[model samples]
Target: MRVSPINAACCVLLVALLGAASGAQATSIYRTTDAQGNVVFTDNPERGGEEVELNPLTVVPSGQRAPAPQSRPEASASPSSPSQAVSSPFMPYSTFRIAAPRNEETLQTGEAGNLQVELGIEPALREDHRVRLLVDGAVSQSAMHSDVFMLGNLERGERVLQAELLDASGEVRHRSAPVTLYVQRASVNLPQNPNNPN
Candidate 1:
């Protein structure tokens, strides 16, 4: 059988194209339409061909697994204040004492036996501490955050007043110097007793 020249030329062209593709890297690709309006892609730039832009390629190894997700550290659960800690290295307040109702002060209010006691603390009181009032070595009022204490119905005689500073855990941290208070209540049987309807 005689070899056709057209077929031989086609085969040679195909081999040449394959050789060019393998020998050089395809850095850019150009797209254009042929005479028959068919789309054609080639590495050679044509007169009216459009250059296609390519993004970076991502590669994954065959048998290698992705890095495990890192774990986030948990936030601290304890409080940030230093005063609340029982093992604080130093005291927060330098001056803690009772400011009002001076020692040996005589109180004669018409309200029978009511007195307002004030506390003096250097700087300021922290949220983790509390104050308690003591009368005659006994707790007259429970612990609270206020700096004032109202004593009601105090016995008509000499009374001892003291203020105690408590920590967050209800532990005594400091105590003011005891104060002596003298109460003068009018006797009911006396002529000046207002409650008597004479």
Candidate 2:
């Protein structure tokens, strides 16, 4: 029952998000352990885990995030609510967004979910700022000082990604427009799959 830091962090992120997004009825969040021994959280009870009841969670529109075509962000940042990430009066960035994994790119069924993401931030990110990746609306991991993110373990399916810049205070200084990526895995039912009996 060992949990990696990344999984632990993901658990925390899910809890934080569920708490912030819950309402009067309170959406239910289920915690489960994946085959890899990684802790996973989801809304599906069928996935199976203890039900966690918490306050309503509001989805953080950590978007308005993105970058220019060739530019990139500077480095190092952390998490805070979108409320805390209000547009600053010092909005100096002209462009920012995910540059790699081009929108609609597809990963072959044989490939693992490893993703190498690049940011296009104009004027270079400010020295006082840090950048983070948002996968499907949730912060992928803590902000860092580099423009490049080597991300792995992406689930098989459609994934939306964005990059956000944070001020020293941890506000959402800037976010890149989201890029969509699909990770395909061989399905037994697929006609092209050798395992397909049909």
Candidate 3:
């Protein structure tokens, strides 16, 4: 079938207008409670229940008038902290504890050092156990025997390491608190005389 040029032009124009209208309607809606305790919304809110506005439109061909990205709410920063995360119901079955290279009262780190972790079961050992170390949700290392897991080449930054202890039944018997290891280059204590032996 032979199509006329005028017909094609009209179809193109129709599509463009529809796209623009849809884009304008696709916006985030914000809600807030009104002074009378009723939920209210407005493109412009003169009073305080909540003021909602579409993120201002911008044209950024040269990246000059780009829109600012939304910032996350302060409460959403970390949902896994001990204070934030809900306590596990299984915690009552087993007691959880973690031993580090340094004392539990304080934590320290070495540049190319190791965090010797020993996970234990309360009331002494009755069954075989496995300990797994997870770094940011990924399994770093798993040990059948309670031994020191080397933490070498730790960068100088705040590192969050998680350790879980599992019993023979493959159930999480215990889990360490998300230990935040503030790693720093270990200060070396060198002997005064390298050549002389006492």
Best by lDDT: 2
Cα error, residue 106 of model 2, in Å, equals 0.9
Quote model 2's TM-score.
0.49
lDDT of each: 0.73, 0.77, 0.52
- List the candidate 1 regions with Cα displacement exceeding 4 Å: 1-90, 195-198
Runs in model 3 lying further than 4 Å from the true structure:
1-94, 101-111, 186-198
Quote the positional error of residue 95 for candidate 2 in Å. Answer: 1.1
C-alpha lDDT (0 to 100) for residue 170 of candidate 1: 91
lDDT of 3: 0.52
Q: Candidate 1, residues 36-94: lDDT per residue as tens digits?
A: 55555555665568865544333446798878789998896987353443233227887
Per-prediction TM-score: 0.52, 0.49, 0.38
**Candidate 3 on 87-189: residue-level lDDT in tens?**
4423333555555633322234422434555644464544476667876566786545554466555555666776666667866655667766665544435
Worst 10 residues of 2 by lDDT: 81-90
Best by TM-score: 1
lDDT of 2 by residue, 39-143 (tens): 888877888898876754444356664554685677757665564444322367666777898999997665667889998777787888899998899988988
Better of 1 and 2 by TM-score: 1
Q: Provide the clashing-pair count of each candidate structure.
A: 0, 30, 0
Residue pairs in candidate 3 whose N, alpha carbon or C atoms collide under 3 angstroms: none
